[model samples]
Target: MGLRFLVVEGNTRGARQAHKQAYGLTLSESYAEVLQEIEGGAVCDIAFPADEGANLPDAAGLESYDGIVLTGSHLNIYDRTPDIVRQIDLMRAVYASRTPSFGSCWGLQVAAVAADGDVRQNPLGREVGFARKLTPTEAGRAHPLLEGRPAAYDAPAIHLDMVTALPGDCTVLAGNAVSPVQAAEIRQDGGVFWGVQYHPEFSLGELAAILERRTDILVREGFCRTPEDALAYTADLAALHRDPTRFDLAWRHGIDAEVLEPQRRTREIRNFVEHRVKTEKSARGRA
Candidate 1:
């Protein structure tokens, strides 16, 4: 049988539309494309509503998919807004199903909260653009979730909140000075949760688009000198992402070639699809 997966969108219509216009794919579409490259299977898209008290997905209803991939969110998890609280409830359902799961940024934060962990606005502020040099913890070196990852690697990131405390049975798999819980693994009675504080699913083009949208914020946050410079910064980064041979241009723009390689940045998701998700499918088939 073919593999099947679900992408739980964390962005609303406004944010998802902007993402589509910039990256030529919606958040769910982008994730589906990435997974398709690895698993070449079906992807199911589901999302939370923008209304005041949207409830979470029913975990029992999620039995169809082999695994779930949680997307990043514009909503901060710490606020406990009705929608966010609902997302946490859905996360609990995900864990209870024992469904192998993977998430990023807000994904990590929500899963942390449901598992009795904590999340907070990083006093250091948003770690946008890049999660630079995330070194794997001792556990990360051996976890299948982190298989094939380098000792230290870079991933595109854009977040204001982070996991400050781990869940009841979770372990820190990867981290850096910017965020102490960059990646984690939670083992519960029924399911397993793996997450990253950065966007391994994001392409550099996506990062560039995000920066383009946030030029004013970046300037105000002291991340860029001027709006024009920020635009140019994204342009150059997007170009180099398309062609690593533009070493000189990349250098002028302050991009490290080693960190700019797409394969290295997307290693985590690749492992999830290839090792965990596929393995689960095979196991169930045999059973």
Candidate 2:
């Protein structure tokens, strides 16, 4: 049998609907598409843990899947709302199940908070559009997840909250000046989670759509001097998405092959499947 994967969307129904309207795909849908693309013939199931009364897999049910992926969310984990609580509970169950898991952006926050770490609104402000110059630590340098990454690279990102305190069993992987916890590996209750602060599944077009929707915040937060400037910037991103060969636009944005190349951007996810998921499947006699 092919690999079976679960995609846990961290967004509520309303947020996901709005995201679908703006980006043409729900976050989990996009994540699932990427997973299928990476691992051919893989089966992916999506669950919305943040939705009220949403059905979630228990530990035994979770063990049926080879791996799990958590998607980014617009909600803050610190609020501890009922919806947020549900996601945390689900993640804890995942840890207990000892499943291999991976996450991005808000997903990373969920993993951190669920593991007894802390996440807070970044005092330095939001790191939107792209996280720049993420350098791997000593551990990350030798980590299989970052095996193909360069000494420093950029990736698409948009987040207001960051992990401030790490759990005892987590190792900091890569970090930039804006966020100290860029990428990490968390081992809790025999379960392992690899996560990054940036969105590997996001394309320039998706990010452009998001930026267009958040133009007001972009201007208010000084990411752009005016709404027109924000729209113009997003236009460049959209244009680049249409034609990645536009080196002029790439150079203007200082975006190199890391963000421009799909394989490089999603190296961690592929690594997780190859190193963690496949290895576990083989160990369980499922491979």
Task: Report the number of the highest-lDDT candidate.
Answer: 2
Off by over 4 Å in 2: none
lDDT for predicted candidate 1 compared with the true structure: 0.81
Error of 2 at 123 (Å): 1.1
Q: How many backbone clashes does candidate 1 have?
A: 1
The C-alpha RMSD of each candidate to the native structure, in angstroms, is 2.1, 1.0
Residue 69 in model 1: lDDT? 89
Please provide, for model 2 over 33-120, each residue's C-alpha lDDT reduced to its tens digit, 9 standing for 90 to 100: 8999999999999999888888888778999999999999999998999999999999999998998999999889999988999999
Clashing pairs in 2: none
Which lDDT tens digits does candidate 1 get at residues 1-287?
A: 66778788887778888888988988878888877776665666566644445554565667668889898888887787777777887888888887788998888888889899999889999898888888999998998878878778777898888887777799999999898899998876578888899998887787888888899988999889898888888898788778878979766855564357666667888788777787887897899
- Please give the distance, in angstroms, between residue 201's alpha carbon in candidate 2 and its true position after superposition: 1.1
Listed per model in order, the count of residue pairs whose N, CA or C atoms clash below 3 Å is 1, 0
Worst 10 residues of 2 by lDDT: 51-60
Q: Who wins the TM-score comparison?
A: 2
